[model samples]
Target: PAGDGKVTTPTGVTASKVTSGAVVLNWQPSTLTTGDGPIAYKVWSNGQLVATSMGTSVAVSSLLPGQNYTFSVQGYSGTHASAQSAPVSTTTAAAPAQKPVRSAYFDQWGIYENAYYPKNVDTSGAAGKLDVIHYAFANIDPTKLTCFEAVKASDSANESNPNAGDGAGDAYADYQSDYNSGTSVDGSADTWEQPLKGNFNQLRQLKAKYPNLRFTISIGGWTYSKYFSDAAATDASRKTFVSSCIDMFLKGNLPTGVAGDASGGAASAAGIFDGVDIDWEYPGSAGGHTGNHYSPADKQNYTLLLKEFRTQLDALGAAQGKRYILSAALPSGQDKIAQLETDKIGAYLDYADVMSYDMHGSWDAKGPTNHQDPLHDSPADPTTPIAPGTRKYNVDTTLAAYTTGLPEYGIPGGFPANKIVLGIPFYWRGWTGVPAGSNYGLYQSATGPTAAKPLSQEAGLAAWKELNPPAAQTHWDPVTESSWFYDGTNFWTGDTPQAVQARGAYAKSKGLGGLFAFSLENDDASGTMLNSMDGSLR
Candidate 1:
């Protein structure tokens, strides 16, 4: 031991884990210690001493955002100061202010089925106003083992739709259709040999015109969710599925089978999407066909799958210098909610879009008529004994479960309130054979399938655009924050501009991020529902 010799300086001083207001500094232990045995290290930043630590690392905090700073370390021995090691420099990330996400879901099949193509959208007054538009949907091709596929005929469920012929989605509509007229967002002709054409190109054009708009491809809806269980069964499978997804959507890897291979040079779809939105119908429950996979382990595996997606997305975002968003269309039913680790799942998501609608519909043959998207439960008799399982599951209860019940399932205090988006429906559910009453058949017993309306022409369903229910019969329920109408034999339940306004107000008051609807095309051609939503949110 060189007792009188000077102590060696700490080597390899470096800064890691740099954040908005903090930087962690680490250095190799000193080579030569004071005669008193081991030595402490002095961490300095910008020539000013910050901290002295017995260990190799020290965390310095309270730094200003977007400020550049350099750090170095020195080995200390008694009263002697060793020379400072090499300095490491870094700039703190600018802390971004949280903005509310006013988002909506767009259906791709709407182009042909409803004749509501991107061109039909009121870009100046409607689509352009939304912050996020989730395109529905992309499915896992069970045959191809790829998550990307052309929107197929079966994917088109518009049997009564006059605009839809054969019900097969047009790939040409996706990227290479010559609309020549109403399709252009700016009344400009399509650019030949463009990196993308058709609706995808139209969307790109729309985004170009409205730079604030962001788009996400929602994968695995009710019709196409059969493969999610298999895709996320394990880490390797999840990687394969996610890789195929990014390649197809984010990377602009066009399917030759449908759109014909066309890459618009280096700028393909490479950055078209700001993120991926998973619309896996029911992860651990049997909401899908009996052939679909269901298991108790799905609750745990679903969380794991989300973790993998977040890991992969974050890695890609880090490389691309953008933060990719992750979101899910969650089940509104408490039974379906049971399969999710609500508290843990939110950690991986940008937001949770709760499908608060479809709580009751014509699908239930002998069901009690109720508000399909009530903000709160129907007032039940407090004294009357009611089974906890039979409790009315409303929007408030769903929000409470995620924000409150998660603790019982292990996550204390559930998910963040601001990360939840209430989902509403833009269509009405109809039921027939209900006993005539003062409430206009609402919350009453009913048989199935009412006669088709003159507009929607569908027996049991009617889009808001086609729903011209007599204004005199329409009634609003303040308690549930919903609306209903019954004309003698037919009972109708759905959201109106007033109901949507009320829901938006409730969401804002509760600190929720925003509200979303199943399909934008369902709204009136004049943009009635969207205008109401925008007005309420503002």
Candidate 2:
């Protein structure tokens, strides 16, 4: 019992990370005799004991923003308590001017032709502003009917193959491919010994640099969603598919490299993805890419599939002590939304990201060169012979279809507004052979999509940074909250910087979850659109 009341004073105490609501205070373990049983730590804030920790660090949370505080540590062994360590003073960050769920989609193929690497997420300043990055995409196994990460792409050319997504993935770009100093996030060339490489490795680095940011592996897309219906068809299939996804992405059991490369193995990409984003395109409808399987049962089955995912993810999270996220890219068309149990599925999702863009594009190709991503409908627009997307094809109306229960149209039960994420397209849809009208090609007859040289990244489309229309005539439609440009014959429907900022303000005004770019790479090098979105949201 001699000197039982005294222990070694804690040392090397410091505040490692300070934020608006929390401070991460860390200290070295005290040196003492083995007789000191069951050592512990006590955190003192402003000279008062605030918390007891079994570890060397404590996250002192729920503090006032922009306030200064002093943190110290004391070691404990049984009834003995060490003298308090020297206090270290620090200030919590000022309150952030934005909300959570600020997300952006990262296209892995950007490395192929667009030269957009994960490093761009950093240099563009998008990483700092974004809290979530949905990496698009991780493909589903065609034969296995499960989530897969491989290097074999069915259509290597990446042309007009509707089934290009089946069993197709870029493991090369995901992890195996090497990043030179110029292309890497940390400006370090990847060596052979490193287990990870390429975009995925860059993502890991970005995650380290931006501790607040999280990366989610987006499963399926317009091009890669061919098998969602089959995968989510029944209970057995859904269980297998979700488990495979958890194994491949959430668990990171990636393939051991593509073809004959031996640089990769299981768990090579573990801890990279924070969750999964289901981009199934459409559930019960025969929409999206060709040969997509759909059935009348998909309506109920879709909700069931999501429940399976939520149940499994929660189980895994409980075991791992982490809350993994689950979200989906909701169909914008009212008809497509009808096939989804929107009201029910929202309960299983962190947020439902509405594909609000591409409302009108060259895909119509019939006549009117229209706004592809209007925020509202124009009263002067054609009112007769309306189709699903022909009318009410705007951000406001599409989101309304989910949150307001369009009873007149038969879709019932509304989703929560706070759980919706708006989509912002970083690319423009163009058309040519348009007869000049008072609306600058809008609501005017057009022959077809533009014959002009399209952006190499996609066909009949132009990236936001590559829009050029002969010094172009520009116009904005205040009624619809849309903007575009034309040069006599070429018409391109795109969003302006102000338009993007307005959308951000619109999200805040409506109490929406957050905003996401269709693909961050298409934005200008200045990240003007993303910055505008963040600035207004703030």
Question: Per-residue lDDT for 275-380 in model 1, tens only?
Answer: 7899887887777544456677788878888888788877765543345678889888776787788879989998978899987777765556777888887673
Worst 10 residues of 1 by lDDT: 380-389
| Best model number under TM-score | 2
Q: Please tell me which predicted candidate would have the highest lDDT against the true structure.
A: 2
Q: Which portions of model 2 miss their true places by more than 4 Å?
A: 1-100, 154-162, 383-391, 452-454, 468-472
Whole-model lDDT for model 1 versus the true structure? Answer: 0.69
Report, for all candidates in order, the number of backbone clashes: 3, 0
RMSD in Å for candidate 1, one decimal? Answer: 15.9
Q: Estimate each model's TM-score.
A: 0.75, 0.81
Question: What is residue 262's positional error in candidate 2, in angstroms?
Answer: 1.5
Global fold similarity of model 1 (TM-score): 0.75
